[model samples]
Target chain A: MIEIQTDPLLYRVQKPEVRERFEALKQRPVVLSVQNLYKTFESQTGTVTALKDVSFDVYRREFMCVIGPSGCGKSTLIRILAGLESSSDGKVLLDGNPVTGPGPDRGMVFQSYTLFPWLTVKQNVMFGPRMSGKRGTSAESEARQWIDLVGLSKFENSYPHQLSGGMKQRVAIARALANRPRILLMDEPFGALDAQTRCQMQSYLLQIWRNLDITILFITHDLDEAAFLADRILVLKANPGEVNEIIEVPVPRPRSAAQFITPEFIATKYRIDQLIHPDQGSPEDALPFPRMTPQGDDVE
Target chain B: MLTMFSFSLPLLAWCAVSYLPFLWHPDVELQISADREGVTTVYTPGDRVSEEFFPEFEAAVRTQNEEVSPFMSLDKPVEAGSESSVRRSNKKVLRHLAPLLVSNGWLTEEQTKDDAAIYVAWKEIATGARLPEQPALTEENLEIVRKNWALMSRYSDSYNADNFVSRPLLSLVPQGRPANPDYLPAPHRVLISGFKEFTKPAEAERPSMWQRVGHSMRIVFGGFLLAALVGVPIGVICGTYSFFSKLIEPFTDFFRYMPAPTFSTLLVVIFLANDAPKMALVFIGTIFQLILVVANTTRRLELPLLEAAQTLGANQAQLLTRVVIPGILPNLYNDLRILLGWAWTWLVIAELVGVKSGLTEFIETQGRWRNFDSVYPVIILIGLIGFFTDQILSFIRGFIFPWTSEGPAITSTPVAKVLLFVPRWFKSAVDERIPYQPESTSPNKA
Candidate 1:
């Protein structure tokens, strides 16, 4: 997925259907909070701190994007939230309780093609339910529904190895959704695709997320991606990694890459560019965006 | 290929040296000098020389030689006599010499009294004797004359064939009736070449050469057939279900490496009270090796393929019958390749102690006698039989693994394909699983 460098999981900020579905989806009544989280890896050279004192809050059905430099522990934070990994110090609360181990409640989409190479696309999508150890016929039927939803009905029997990278990831997303987890944790899921495939995947992801009111914790490295996909972006810094700032696009609901040329989109783009690289904030300055605070308030 | 050369080059060199003399000097040509006036050339005495002219060879050794001796007496002087009397004496020498010639392989079952004349005639010319028939040589007498010279030259100083323990004088008969012949040596040299061309042998003797080849053929054919018979069902069972595999695993694990001799010895001890102890030992030895093949191959039945069926919810029975067996068959045949090889080693070892009639026994007997001539041929026969059987097994592999040679493997991944197709012994074993089938896919019989 080429656009991985642009924005790992930030879905395309376009398509009127995504807006329509967003309005149509029934929001899950749940809240999430990251309280002073910290994560570190022990290596032969000693410990490398990946996250330090990172904190944030997400309301029911809110789309949150975690953005930072390469290897900045944005993944670590998302993994911690999904309970795929344990945080060294901190608590990630879902519905007011600390998250623990991976369960049916939160479905995760990894960056790799985890579609189980041996199984077909449809079977891959149905895996979560099947692993839940239900009957096979029913699983197949439910798998078909998701297959149709992802517009991959024709490829239901196509193996992951046979499908293109984007196709494989779409199957992964569908599988995550089929489980009907309250929260969707995407860990740079589009990072492996080629550029064109990444764009196409982003648009599809937006469409699906809109149709389903799943709370999404989308992680990425692309600043523009953070602006385009997130209702709110948690901008993080490397080295004792922390949330450096929060920025909002303030754009209207429906958007597209075509809107990227607009004066308002360009202005907001400048604000993020300045926040990430303030010294370079000069006559080249362009897009304007509102910087939000950790208090969840505007810097009035 | 490197390993093949590593194993074959030395053997090839040995064969080259062993047979090199045959290529350069097929007839064992020798030069004779009676008075040292000049050397007279001699060729081996056989119809083959008359049938196939050695024009260049004959011209090369064209010299003069003269001596008045016929048949050589190993340790005595040849007394001269009248032409007819000496000729009659030589003929009598051959007929009377039949038993001794038979012992030394110069005669055969069918040789009779009339045949001794041929030996005498050839012996006369071979000694550079002035034969009355050779005036002076008539085409008839000269032919017999040249042959006699060849026989004498065959035993010249180099061969020292006169060392036949004893000898006698010879006579040249010039006055015999030209119309009818009295006797001759048998048509050919029955002494064998380099001592390796011993006959096929009769049943009672079960000569060392025959025992090795015959015994190995039984095992190669029988062990192969038995392994196929044995490996199929068990391989399918163990391959299909990990449980049957698990159930048999402990025993196979314990016995697989127990040393075939030990296995046979133990079986013999336990089954000694039975009627046919040796037969029982062989059966036990074969069974143990076969189970090892089945269990080992079963444990590694191309996991990806089996997993495909398992994930499909194929019941254990279905897995066993359809996916496991069919998919693993090529592998089972491949196991037959290895199984037969191991079985042969075991068979030899089993026959070593318990049984006394197989090739190993032949070798043991010959070894005790220090008759390496008898022993080596058997060993060679064993090798030849082993080669042929391996080829048979491979021919079977080629059929069963038709996909291996022709198209993509049943599995898509190269690794999976290799794991599903190549025999374990041949495999580099880069992975944990081995791929083989136990069956007779040989186009020859099965």
Candidate 2:
């Protein structure tokens, strides 16, 4: 755990009430907690246990990121939570209620842009709301709001074919948000984006969080992305994916892209790098999925 | 001698096949029976128009003699000799159909009316001569206009004014032609004029040419429309859902390979009991082909589109409606383009089974009496009309899906942002991920 710099945005934030509410919101208990979760798939080749006993707790307004190397169960865990894939073992608690199936209360944003090709952007966004039995003026208003929130106001009437990749992804994000889920699950949501667009989306995501403060459980293979948007980063190891360590990131609120250049940022990055690649320092650090050595254990 | 050899081959083959143990005898002689009111003639060979529609054929001969005798001949272009009635009537139809299609977006509207003047002045020797270029219209637009004129001219030649009103000998001599003892043309409908005993049709039997063409064209067109209507929705459904795709695909695949004649046979047996067997046959044939189209379209729902729909919090029903159906339009249009021929292939088979109507039955009638000449032209009419129907449907596809042509042409590869070093696959991946907004890029994020 590193002590974080004061959130740079705290100085510029003009609302005193928001600042007070933010602190009060931090005091709220964890709404959903995932503990010692594990998942394995039985394929034709053999049983591939993709996730090992992973643990994390998400409080309201917290934005947590699960980052690891490829083949680590970051996406698998998200999929399990999304109800797309069943977990071999473990339970997910949403507001202390066990998640037995997918519900509108837990919105998931996929990495791929999965818009209905025929539907215009507004209709695609309206889809979930309509299915949930929300209709007429209320549905239309909510659809318009979300479309604008994703910054797709101009493209609301355009078909998916007419939109670019970024626009499609934005509509996906808006669709998820329109559900107003208590927990937002994003599985490497920006991994497919270009470097520039990924940063833009990240900032937009952060801004939206600042407004709505929904609990976030994001999975990423990129360390920089994990560091930028994550409140706490959980690193996982490959080969029967398991969480190695839960690193607390104390970087102040409202960090910008420029903050990545700070010395402290580099130091934290080096430490994470050391955990992922132990040969950079001592061999003893190479233990899989992190088990702390007993007090007097010798370093190899 | 060559004609005799050409005509006898099929008859010989049929006779040999009929004798084989497994093969059945086909005594299918085509015949046209007559009513007291209308004339009937046996098949023969001087000309098809003259033999098939007797009174109309005779009328055409008389009209041609009176209308195109000395000056109004088809020998020269309108520009070459004196522009005559033969040329003028054809030019009128050509100009009318061309502008009609262009105004309706079936053809490209000319940017300038200069094309009309150019077409009016066309000649064989001077077909490529440069004309006045005083307008601000682009050369490309002019080229399109000029090509349109050439099309109009080509069509203008095909509809000879003298041939439009042919009178057949059948209607002229409904009682039957008198046998010329010296020229015993067993085929029928020949008047050795001075022989008072020659066959002549009762005065009431003659019908108009336009009426017959109108009737046949309606049936042909109705069959085309039935295929389009039934096939398009099935295509949309199969394209939209994996479940529908799973259920519909195998059967459609199996049926498509089965010879269309088999379906026609089955259809003839079942539909022969129906009140309107011709309509039923068209329905059966169209449905068979449409089912295939639906299945093929199911296979082309854009991959990204499916993924995108799932990401949108879409449940099963929404998934089917939004992502699956619309993504496969291009594929559907293409499948219909292919299946149109299949439906029409069965058109002949279906029509041939005990049908007294349609060109197929008419051709069969000519065949029974050895009217080889009439049969060939009817067969040619079938092919030409099928081709024409395909063109019309393809035109409709173009109008509905304008992006289809432009898409594969202009969008296969976009201009690269960096020099050639960037891998195309990598670029495509980036293109998929990145949001398109110029503002989304943070000033220094790149």
Candidate 3:
């Protein structure tokens, strides 16, 4: 076995101010709690563990991000929290009550486009309330307000197919918020968008969170995304996924694009990167292809 | 321009085969006909025979005329006992000239039935008083007509049944023009015959063309509505739940493979000789396919939509009605449109069974008599009805499911504007009842 040295600068140590802020956040009422969560799948190859002994807590009005590698069960955890999937061994509590199945209290937005193609933006936003037995006029007005909040009032009568990808996701966000859920569970909701749109959406999401009295559990694979918006980040390990660390982001509040270059933001992103890519190094030495380039013609 | 060419190409091809005689005219249609001695086969002026057989027919009539001339010129012309029989034969010969007289426009159709009028027309033609222009008499036929009239005038100045039988009349030689066989009537002939048939008054035993068309429409629509009524709900259930899908789809898949028409005999026996059996055949033909198609369309609905609805507090019943139904409706409408066309394929086979009703029945009867002109009209009518119905349905689909991106947006043509009136009015009416008024333009601040 080869020995590897850990990067001393990126070590898992919380500064005094960050710890104090975290302590203050914990004093608020818990909105969601997960205890010893486990999920497994039965396949032809035999049973495979997808998640193992995961635990976490989210306070009221908290903005939490779960960041991990591809197979780290980030989706499975979000699904279980949203009551879209059942855990093999765990308990999920929302406001001290057990999470049984999906309800209006936990609004979900998927990574894939999920807006009903047959309904206009306004109608899609009205759907949740309508299903809960709210009549037309009330539902319509509430839907209109939500549409306005998402900055999509002009497109309220447009179908999903007519909207661009980012606009569609915004409509989806408005649709979810219309239900007045206690918490929003977003599973990489901007993952499919372009880089520019993704940044815009991150800012839009942060603004929405600031305005509303709502808690959010956002899942992403991008370290920059988590560091930019999250109050705290939950990092997990792959291969029977388990929690690696819960970092209280050292970045200042009211985040802007200018703060992305700050030392605290860089340190938080570096810690997530180290956790997700612990074996990271140059991969060229592992490749079997023989070098065919002329001497001293380096690209780096 | 392409649409015009699509229809005109076939019509142009038909015209080529019809009016351009040099293309393919294997037979000769008779303009004037004759009777053969000792042969009972009577050829009419419009009857067609093979090109090779026309000369033999003409020769036979000429031979019979030669054999009769010598007997008539003899001094002792007749026997009293057989004079009536001779007069009867002469009367038959004069009646043969009736068709020729009508074609020349000298005699009306009803006047052809009057024996005295036919006698006068033949006298005028022989005397060169009335000239037939459209189909001028050949020199040989005119000579035969004069000889026959000379023999007839010797017996009577006007038609007298007793005097008309005094001697035998010479038959006109057969003459003809190159023509196609009777089964493939010319396009103009078909148009003329079709017009007459449609305008003809209904008789005691026969229904008019319009009635037959109405009957056919009833069968197709009745069967389709019934299938949609029953199949949509079952298909939706099958599509929604795995338990129902497994329970129903396997058998339906199996049943769809068995041809619908194969059950026609059974339907006829069960329903007993009326419209019921025909409608039942169409229903059976359509329902199995409808259920399978609708179920598949329902299955194709993306899973994300359902999951999203579930997370938004939709219960099982709510998921089906609000999410599943609305999600599959555009595709379902499209499927039903195609299946309605499928149902029409059964119409011909369905109407053929159990008492033979509708336009197909008319086609069958006219085709049996080799009246192909009449048959073409009914067959074309069925095709036109199916084509226009499908086109209109496709046009209306854009209005019914406006959210779908598959078809063109509704245009502002006069017909489209008229069709849009009802839906627009209904939407405005609904809008009025809802008291909430949204801001016309809300600025986006995010």
Candidate 4:
């Protein structure tokens, strides 16, 4: 039971009358709500606040991409949501139930090749269902379906080491999807791939999401990647990372490389780049936070 | 020619030492006499019984039975050059001792009577007191004469009395010559003639070398199987759970540092002195060290693999069975191969403890008998078996874990080709766990 919103944008950007009329339609129900999240990292030098008062909501079947510069805690937020790491405070709710830890309900694909090196491509995909106590012909078929969906039917018997990096990531995706999770969390899944392979992977991932009707929360540092793939792009500012903006993509879906040169795509990419780098063209531009602060100045 | 010389250097050294005395005094023959009691004396040809060394034999007779002691009750004194008097008294002594020496098979009656007179005559020539009509004793005959003296001295009924002498061999010549029955035989003789014993049935008192080797192999296999079965699971559990590791590590570590042989007393208290103690020795020798090695290998498992398994919804039991065990298997197998070799070092120590019947005991007994003809081959056999076992383990490891850096050895031989089939069997074994899925009728369907 998903409620569809006629107005895809969360916040209105057009005329007041038109925006009000569009908002009168049904709004999509939230699939995941992350609220008041904070994460702090302690080290020998001092305590570093990685994420502070971060909050976001992803709707059902929504393709949400989180973009940030290095050290912005975008990866940390997704990891906390995946339950691989714990949040210092606040909760991540999926289907209105709090995620306590990593479970079958949430599947993750890491940037590294996380496919089981000891198992074959088919065996890696089958690992989830087999561990969940589903076996025999049914589990085999489910694993095979995902492997084929990832365009790896021919390499089913090959080990992870034998496959290329992109193929390994594809197997990882299939392995995550074999559990039939409600949400797929990808942490820079295509970041390790070459340019051509990354583009292909982005398109294939889009196709999979459309066909399976699965919600996805992708973490990336690439501006064009977020602009082209996300229904909404969440941009974060660094140094105790905070949410700067969430821009809704107005471009039509079923997108491809032809849309890469479109003005709308270029405008969204520029806007995200500006938000991440507020003082884009100024020579005096530096980190918003002072490089060296006085002793005992707002340590938290 | 150079290769032959390189191999013959030791043989040449032995020859030079053996012939050195003859080079010094070509006319004389030196006879060395030895026996089970370890009494030894060197006798030269033409030396009389009074001049030769049999003082212990004389003392033994005087203490054992005074009435029969010729040295105690001689009618004529045996002066150095008094041939007639010495011969007369020696003949009487020979007559009195012939029946006893004959009963013990030490000397024949003719040897005692005629040989005793000849020895007296040779004594005059040896000391330059008289000229012989013709030379009667040569190097070969002198050896027989020395043998006669050794037999007489050893078989004397009172030889074990306080008069006993412990004499090591006269090593003016190199040792280990077949001519000296007490010396170890040459290496070639051991490998050739010693191997002939395996072609026939074994005796009741001592089995053949092959049979002893079989027994040792069985014991090693039993101990290795038990250690692998018990140690591997404990190691896996210990590695998986930090608390279990903490509980088991202190004791295993402490015992590993202590000598494994020190446990023989406890083994004896728990089990009978038979094969149980022997097998327990081999087991105890390796199990503690193996547990530590395997536990370390498991602890060093890649963290990302475990995290991937967790994200894949693996329970604790599934994680252990599917991921952890397989992850550490290749390294564990390498650890096992090394430990099996270490177990061989303990094999001798283990078999030597109680009711010894293995190759080590065989070697020990043969060494005591001065039969290196049998002892050397058994040692070589143990080395050969250990070497081949290591090769087989390496091949099996390569076969099972092909993904590991230890790839199978490449060859075109028929045996290698047949061994290549072994991986198929391993694949089938694993196929039961992750069943093979056939290709879908349609290749690309989302």
Model 2 chain B: which ten-residue window has the lowest total lDDT?
B166-175
Which CAPRI level is candidate 1?
incorrect
Candidate 2 local lDDT, B260-349, one digit each (tens): 456555666776733245555555566666766676667655564554345445577766665565566767766767766765675565
Candidate 4, DockQ score (0 to 1): 0.24
Residue lDDT tens for model 4, A188-295: 999999999999999999999988857899999999899889988899999989999887775567899999876667767777877787766533444364556578
TM-score of each: 0.52, 0.57, 0.84, 0.69
Query: Candidate 3's residue-wise lDDT over B122-222, tens digit each?
Result: 78888989867767788988898888888777777688765574677787888788999988889998999899988988787888889889999999999
Q: Cα lDDT for residue B251, model 2?
A: 84
Task: Arrange candidates by TM-score, descending.
Answer: 3, 4, 2, 1
List the candidate 1 regions with Cα displacement exceeding 4 Å. A1-31, A267-300, B1-109, B112-446
The number of the candidate with the highest DockQ is 3
Per-residue accuracy of model 4 over B13-87 as CA lDDT, tens digit each: 655544454332222221222221234553322222322224453343334333222432224343455544433
Give the range where candidate 1 chain B is weakest over 10 consecutive residues by summed lDDT: B176-185
Docking class of 2: incorrect
Best by TM-score: 3
Candidate 1 or 3, higher lDDT?
3
